[model samples]
Target: MEGHTGCTTKIVTLCTFKLSDAHVHYRTPLTSYFISHTSHLTSHWQSITLQNLYLIPHTSYPIPHTPYPIPHTSYFILHTSYFINNIYYL
Candidate 1:
């Protein structure tokens, strides 16, 4: 989050929602995410689907000379790890 907008303050927040509609085909037509940005320095809001959602405190990688090496992305990605049906997030 450094040098992105020339702001050193970290107010980034990652929000994720996992949705599963029980149907043989398309059953649910809903855009179930609320995202808004009042300012450029506001926290980051992202809407993504996940089979399993887990929160990690911090993540590290083998990148060099990176201000924020730890990714601020969602801890769980959609349809990758855990699999479940009829999962509704509220």
Candidate 2:
């Protein structure tokens, strides 16, 4: 999925792999900005809070955004759990 407000933007992606024991989850923001930080994926459900929800105007698959574009931004989403896997890209 994709969302855009104007020109500031970052690519957000999430992938989940079902394993025999648990899920192997992959996220773009986590791996892109924090390569040194890693966390184990689990089947357990998680909760998160999303703030400043906006109705983007752009109709791109990978949403583009703000007054100007900002590449490789990690602080795009207020909360990661706000979007499901493969549904939002900003």
Candidate 3:
């Protein structure tokens, strides 16, 4: 994975293989910025979200309800779950 920063923005990049099977997961403790991507031999999976103090964007994936205290800024946690065949992996 690669992370980049601009004047007031951040970017992240990741690479994967086509034949590979993978699942990605993410969670945040506070409002923050996060983006994720998965690469296949033919295409890539991309997602981006910005968490604000007042509101957060809707995501296709469901987020768990946790009772962690949130600060004024943004926080992000990213996790990827990978599985192959009948085997479980991360």
All candidates: TM-score: 0.22, 0.17, 0.18
Tens digits of per-residue lDDT for model 3 on 19-89? Answer: 12323234454533232232221244334221211112334234454234342122222322332222111
lDDT of each: 0.26, 0.27, 0.27
TM-score ranking, high to low: 1, 3, 2
Residue-pair clashes per candidate:
0, 6, 2
RMSD of 1: 14.8
Better of 1 and 2 by TM-score: 1
- Which residue runs of candidate 3 sit more than 4 Å off their true CA positions? 1-64, 72-74, 82-90
Top candidate on TM-score is 1
Query: Which pairs clash inside model 1?
Result: none
Model 2 residue pairs with clashes: 6-65, 7-65, 7-66, 8-65, 8-66, 10-90
lDDT of 3: 0.27
Model 1: how far residue 31 lies from native, Å: 29
lDDT (C-alpha) at residue 61 in model 3: 31
